[model samples]
Target: MKRGRLALGIIGALALGLGGSVVALRAGAGETDRAELEKRWADAPSRFVTVDGVRMHVREEGPANGPVVVLLHGSIVNLHEWDDVVPLLADKYRVVRFDWSPYGLTGPDPSGFYSTPRSAQLMDGLMKALGHDKFAMVATSNGANVGLEFNRAYPGHVTAMAFSMLPLERPSQTRKVDWRLKWMLEAHKAVLPNWRHREFWRLMLEDTTPPEFTPTDRMVDQITEMNNLPGALDRQAQYIQANVRAFQSSDVGAVAEAVRVPVLLQWCSFDDVISQSADASVKRFTNTKVDVINYPDLGHFPMWEKPEKFTRDLRNWLDRQPPAPAG
Candidate 1:
């Protein structure tokens, strides 16, 4: 009975501490010396490719001749998010991962513009520049939003879609916002500075990751290093500020409807913010297969949370789908 009480007390204390942290709202860190940051965060399989007029950071692995799978990571995360998952599919499928502007090693957008449409264009052009006319795509978080645009803009080029943390471009679920949600949204905006902080993101990962999976010290350190990439914080802030009013209802649904290839959506059952997108996209998608798998424990990034399980499930799902077009 004492132990149970102690556990409850600890939980309550943690809740209060997190709540206080959110309320405090700290400023994000500025970039350290460029040379130092570049040396620390630039990992293997790195290359620079000129896409359209913009230079992007690319990481290519697996057999060059194999069917290609392009990966788009979540906001505030770099291509390394796919590090574990890459090898799982690399031998059988060529994997291409890149750092989109305003994040990762790619740095800022030269045009000072960032939106789903622009990112979609970048993805399509990047694949083409890599000599891949047709490929499958996997994106997470905001990356999924860009993937929707990619499919909408260049349907012929994408053979399959897999999106985790997919954002649905649909009408607000409610016409009225209660004080709590309104307050929460406002508070989120108020914490804009911390959004650029690596420690904040690290704490988020710890709070969000399921108990079954433990994020190693190395994992957290690597993620923090990426967050501290030179100029990334400023670029990300600028992009978000520019895109405050970006999406309209049906914008994402229309993209989903236009997708003519196999698509898989993986969501966590408890994730109310993004899991609903699976249902939203499934209803809108008509031309090709749209499948959803809900994990009992995983959060937004199931691929990172349960890499092996996610890879196995993905491989099985891909096997069941119509194979990609020949190289």
Candidate 2:
């Protein structure tokens, strides 16, 4: 009886403390209006289009008649991640970048689904909307998997693909989360209010990138602002909570095997998130010609760390590929 009373008292105290902290912090931490964010972040080429009931924030540049090149950013980031590389490509190929649901100005998906197949479908819909029946793809991390899935589901639409930091784990591997840790994670999500944590991102960037890479203030600020938007944090939390099932069931090896088009693996040796080596990933694509170029000094985000060199290397690869089928 005494122990039960003690536990109840502790729970009450924690609830009161969290509530007080939430009230104190929520003044400046409230969700930023979506329109206000659009005005600030959306540039000249930016447009919102409805795809599968989700209004996607997309940007297009270069000549309309130029061959299309779609850029997909990794998880936790939006289309702005390609800002550095866009200018270099825009004068030549038609450059396209967009924010996937639950990220950037796109916010949460109404359908509440974020599987790789769904992402592939959305990409096809977006490209179709833009009159691109086929295009090349350049993607990183989670986005790279989306590209692989796109090639599998839509096939032939992706004439060529260049990827960096592809997180392709096998279907047989499973992550077992400790029940105590899972409970704590749930508690943390429940008790804490949704808000931007710039310090968390700063630490993450510092830990993930090499010493040569310094995350600029603008990069931190933009990410912070994006996460602070309404429903963004909740959506991200929901996605993270589903990771054990999602990662385990992913058949990336099968997807890679289905690729008949050429592939470029832009590997970052210092990447802390994915495997530092690309040998395993290269072997997975048994059917296709997989060309590799290693960035020995860079980490997860080579484009942000070395934009000019990244663009130059990517442009060279794209130049070598045969032209896509006419739309």
TM-score, each model? Answer: 0.78, 0.85
RMSD vs true structure, all candidates: 7.7, 5.9
Q: Can you write out model 1's per-residue Cα lDDT over 1-327, one digit (the tens) per residue?
A: 999999999999999997776555342334345456557666566778887678788888888788878889987677878888998998788888998766676756678777778888887778878788877888888888788788887778888888777766532354333455455445645664334454455555655566566776766766666656555566777655544466532354566778778888776754444535556667877777778887878875677888999888887776676656544
Can you tell me which runs of candidate 2 are displaced by over 4 Å?
A: 1-21, 24-28, 170-193, 325-327
TM-score of 2: 0.85
Best by TM-score: 2
**Residue-wise lDDT of candidate 2 within 195-222, one digit each (tens)?**
6457656655666678878899878877
Give model 1's TM-score versus the native structure: 0.78
Instruction: Please list the C-alpha lDDT of all candidates, in the order they appear.
Output: 0.71, 0.79
Error of 1 at 17 (Å): 24
